[model samples]
Target: MNEGYRKDIIRYLSVLNNLGGCHIDTINGFLQKPSYIGASPPVSLFPSSDGKSIGDALYQLSIVLERMTDNEFDDTTFYHSKQLKSPLGPEEVRRLNEISLSAKVTQDYMNTIGRVFQSYQLFELLSSLEEQHITLISKALTSIFPMDQSITNDISTSKQKNYQGIIEKIKQLFSRTKIELFLHLREEIEESQKNPHKSSISQATILDTLDIKSSEYYLASALRQLLSTDENSLTTLVNELRKIQPLQITQLSLLPFKDFYQILDLQANFIQMANTYQFFKEDSNSQFNISTASEIKMPSTPEIKIVDQPPDKAIYKRNVKPAPSVSFQGDSKDLDGNYYVSVALLRCNDFSEEPTFLNGASKPTKITNGKIVTFKKLKVMVTSHQQGETLFCFRFDLRRYSSDPETNPNDFEIVSSVHSSPISILSHSTQLKSTAIADLPKVTEVFPLSGPSTGGTRICLLGSNFADTPAIRLKFGNVEIQPEFFSGGTLVCNAPEHPPGTVQIKVSNCQNQWSVTSATFTFEDTNTINPSSNISSDALSNILPESVFGLDFSKTFDTNFIIKGLETASSTLPSSNGAHRNYSKQY
Candidate 1:
């Protein structure tokens, strides 16, 4: 009986795996196979047939299965069923009988099957059973699993918080321009809804009449409210309206009231309407009125003062100062071909402060031809100061009027000249005298000379004194040759046209007395000799170097012997005349 109980439990588990979710077809396919076997218990070594004892154990199994299915068990139901004198109680017997009589369990047996299904992960089993059945099995498993109410509430709160955050961000973006308009439009809409005839029909009403969505409808409605009465505020509102129109007007037919003139007319109408509804007014003529609620004063206009001055006759006066000549070193071009003059004024000993005209003094500096002369005003006060015997240094950039006199009405001409003030040589006695010698021009060590034997050898004469110096004269032994000076301390020259021997290449600057000499260079004439002719006989005494004629010349010492042998061999050979005679005779 114990073995049978285990077998029954195994069969119940197997059946649950098949019957769960929408896995009916897959379960049927697996069960129809020959190899497929239903769950059976291991053979029980000890068997009991005592109905009361067996029924007690069966009753327990029944209660366990019921608990697995419903996820809860009733102790009262179990107790009442256990009193019956049967092999199994009413519920337990019925479940066992169903398993025994059928090859497969039907949907009616689902309650018992659910008990076993709940014991194991039915979803995992169903996943392997069929692909299509996964979602159904997942739903079933979710339904069976116990949920935490607190966790669910927390998730819901988190979602609500995220939604609120998104809403706040959207409101912030809209509030920049749209919100104010929306509020005004909403007020108008509310008023329109309350009293249709009393409220002025806005262009926003046309947008609403087109049955636009809330997002699209609000922008136009809001903009119309912003420009309702104030025409001066229309400029700012028009710019804001441009941004909204493109975003909101996906369909062109929605906003029928979009002409500029129509908008202006609407604004004018709103102004007129607002002016007509003014409830309070100031009574300037009356001292007091009892019926008047309150009298408000309008803001007065600000007064502007204007002064008139008689035009003076044109008088030419010169307040000119002599300027020294200056040489500008760089590219300078006139913007309009007008003569520009720049002068560098020297600072003098008496010049305490930089030159500046006194307050209200007009010193019109004019340039006639290419020279600048200042025009004297009636009450001009000019003062000169010297600092340690030098006046303040000033650079005056003046433009000439004669060059393009028609264009310049100021009657000032820029002197096409620049000036430098006298160099203020301080008194020698007061100036700090340095005992140390002034920085002498640096003389660099000459680089080692290098070049070909064909006379012109370029040698880099490296040193500081070489800079700005015209020619660098290099001494090759006693011969002095001036090298072409190039930028980077390089000197190119013929190497004194020396013989094919080692010569000392020396370098000296044209400006300096000191000379730099290089170590002797053993010059070899590359075109002079055949290199093979120079090979010593001692080096090739035994094994002869191969001759161009492929002969062992070292071994063949006797030339006369070779000549005699060639002569004897020629005697044995047919002569050219003899061969010609034989050919003639044969013919």
Candidate 2:
């Protein structure tokens, strides 16, 4: 027997041995094989053996098989097969044949049971039927069974009749039950349509008829329908159900506007209204106005003069007030009759001069009484002079009345209003000096130009520009290393440990001045070898030869040498050893 098949037989045997109240022949029939008197414990438990031992083993095997078949092992062919070639009586043989036939029938029936359940469509349909109808169908079908057999003769004929009867009964029952279910469903649907509030009842009925669990899709669909009808009560009920079954809520397809657009529109309108009200209130408080003005000019000759001149007291004033005279003047008189007059004049000097210049000037050449007189044409001539010579000047004088002439000047007190020039003091001063060269230091060299892998190695940087305390930065390749500045020239930096190779170090100071240096360093595996490990050439040479030239006895040894003394060694040993000893003694 194949080893694999033998193992399968062993598992079957174990199952049979553990089963209770089963028969030997029935178990053999389940195995689809005759019981052999000696099968070497099914070849899995033991090897093949002769008839005498086989007979005893078969008897024990039968006991195990008996428990497997539930004691239904009266099938004679399975038991009689243990004798192998022995001829059986006619009556015994006939009985064995009948048992074989019945065993085949039982196996066929068991096989059909599994197939029946595998028909998924049938199971689904049966599941959809009303519970009462299902129970009635089962009872009616079961009734024609084993019950009819007990009361009838000729077992084969009775079984056939019962089977046919139950099948017919199930068909008739399903037909009647379906008709009733359809009528009920129709009425429920009709009522639901009349009153959408009762739609839940109709929905439940349809789901029950289809035998579908109240899944998320189903519940959500029902909830959505209720919401569509504007049934607040139904909607609330559905929402409450969703809380209990969160999955149903997740499955629901929310109405697009209900949760999104409508809420957005409402917020937008509220914001717009608030803005509109703000604009309206602002406009009410502040009114707008528009006005226009016309431009007019008076000639320098004064179209009219309103001065009171006393007869016989002529007021003589200075002629030619100054070059570039200011023609326009404004004065405002307070209730006290004190005049506050301000004058603006354009300057005509190559450089500006102080107002004090006006205090002491040569008296006017032409004087009328105590007032100065100017030719009207002369005033016009000054206004049209060359660009640098003609200018407009402004002046302001405050005139106040005093009770005593000695206490305050009755003459106008001239006040000078000069515009100060806008210039920065820092720009005007030329004494400020530039940075001295003594402040800058020079750089020399960087040591251990490389960094540590774990980073943190203090390296000495040699150079100048090292101030009292200068910040240093180390650069390896394009990557820069941040260093701790310990002193002016000395920097404590952790060398960035990099891959084993030559690296460049750039040392810099607080002034951003840097110097580049190169260093070659090897990265050693600290775990496997000491960082300071060194090997001489001689030591290496000696170790290499010993390891490479070593011989292995295991590879050279033969089976004959392993099992016995060497035959070849015996023939050559004596003469060769004698000759070698004599030759050595002579030397």
Candidate 3:
């Protein structure tokens, strides 16, 4: 009989001992941690006391053991493991301790009406209570994890129910918890829109209070939906997460945007371990049936058509201005409501890549004549499109979009796509435009042709067909600056500091249009010039090779000094054969 009892004890203890790892630790710590109210025990209902009966004694013993686990008896002179102070009084710890032992053996045994059983039954009772304790902490606390108004209502309306009914109730509570978490996250996201820098509640606090382990997929889907609606929420959440010391976001600050996706992906893998504890099951063989929860319905793919296709050649000035935009029209009747519409810019070469398809649950869906037109798809835009709307305009944000194909074949593949026509998109500076040379602006002359290399020299540039706009710039060699003031035929600008040499001057409208002047401006070094010293013509002809090769010595002197020590050197140095004063070397 003792052996049989030991087997039962071992079996129950095995189940009890299995409660380890992050899930159980998280739940236990969550229960043990101080609530917003105060630092209090998990429950007052199971307080230790001298029992009225044998069953009552068992309950008291359970409470005593639990308090031992909580280290309630530990003090300056004693530890619970080595020497424990009894709850009844401050007494030295022993198996034969006076107060607690007398209460358990004499008072409880005499008061009991039933037959006194073997000591094995007591061990069995203790194990059973422990199992109940685990269950109480893990399951019963689900409805009151965070202890909000909703939980108060649940407790007020609570009643006794059957086993199956109780299971259903727990499941419902889990669903409600998920909903509350979603609502809280939505509120944070909305608040972030008003003040992006506002710190949100910590995710650790949320994870502890919300019981996220049981509702992983639900919470994940909620987060995914939230991201789909407002992408800025992710940025706000990430910033808030960076505040957590354990996440080690100090190192993550240097990580690229793609690394954030990888971090999220790793966190998402925890879904596989979600709801792993099976407290309701009788044994390992017992099947736990979980009814499928309702999910967010993904709307059917609408037939997308380009209503107002962008020009064949669109100019994107990077971040200076808004990116290229195209107006698209989707079937309003077919689409039930507004949904996310993603736009891609695919090159002409992408259409001829190996055929690929968007892998769906049932079958692969092809795009654009089944030629895998979105192989090298650059996802430039994502905008919300509504039904019955005349047109949905998507402005491409190509700041992160890449046109290059993956060097690694194992890279992430796109599963859903829509792309624009084969269009050549060029940057504002690189875009080619045909303009007649005769119609272009011409720089005829520049007043005060020379200025000190110390800069701050006001000069007037005389030109023809000069753009009468503030956008016009006077470019001296590689250095460019906006005019202080400009008109149709003339503009004035302060000379930017340069080396003591002549640089070709030009008037640029910044639209890839330049009015080149045959003349140049000389930045004479006043400090280096000596009117009394008469240098021979042969000595003045010996120019530094750095000036000829355009070697920049700006770092040492640090003033955009492209050429140095050429205060009196002429623009062209005479050759050894004395051919022409126009001696120049084209490097």
Highest lDDT: which candidate? 3
What ranking of all candidate models by lDDT puts the best one first? 3, 1, 2
Please, what are the lDDT tens digits per residue for candidate 2 over residues 1-587? 11122212222333223223323222121121122333432111212323424233333332223222322242332333332324556776555434333232223222221122111112222222232332332333333343343433232434444444433332333333434443455455556678967744545655566343565123323222322322343333323332321111111111110223332333243234334322223352233111000001111211111111111111112222112111112221221333222322223222233333232232212112223222221111222123332232222222333333235435433221221111111211131234223334444554433333543433444554443221234565555655544346544343555565555555543324345333343333335545576666566444423211121112111111111233555312221111111111000
Residues 396-456, model 3: lDDT tens digits: 2111112322343222222223233233334343343553354456887665567678666
Whole-model Cα lDDT per candidate?
0.31, 0.30, 0.35
**Residue-by-residue lDDT tens digits, candidate 1, 1-587:** 11122223432333332232333322221121111233333212012323433223233233334223221222222321232113335776454433322212222233333323222222122222222122222222223232344553232323333333332332343434443544455456556667957866665573554333465443343334333433334333333323332112111111121232332333343233223422112432143221111111111211111111101111112222221222222233333344343333223322223333222222323223333233122211232322333223333445544544456546654332222222322223123134111112233433223333444432334333342222235566666665555333433333445566666655543223334334354445647644567545555444434333222323221121111223465322221110111111000
lDDT of 1 at 575: 16
- Give the distance in Å from residue 476's predicted Cα in candidate 1 to where it truly belongs: 25
Candidate 1 wrong stretches, greater than 4 Å? 1-393, 398-412, 415-587
Report lDDT (Cα) of residue 87, candidate 2: 54
TM-score of candidate 2 against the unseen true structure: 0.16
Q: Total backbone clashes of model 2?
A: 45
Which structure among the candidates has the greatest TM-score?
A: 3
Candidate 2, which ten residues in sequence have the lowest lDDT sum? 578-587
Models sorted by TM-score, best on top: 3, 1, 2
* All models, RMSD in angstroms: 47.9, 51.5, 31.8
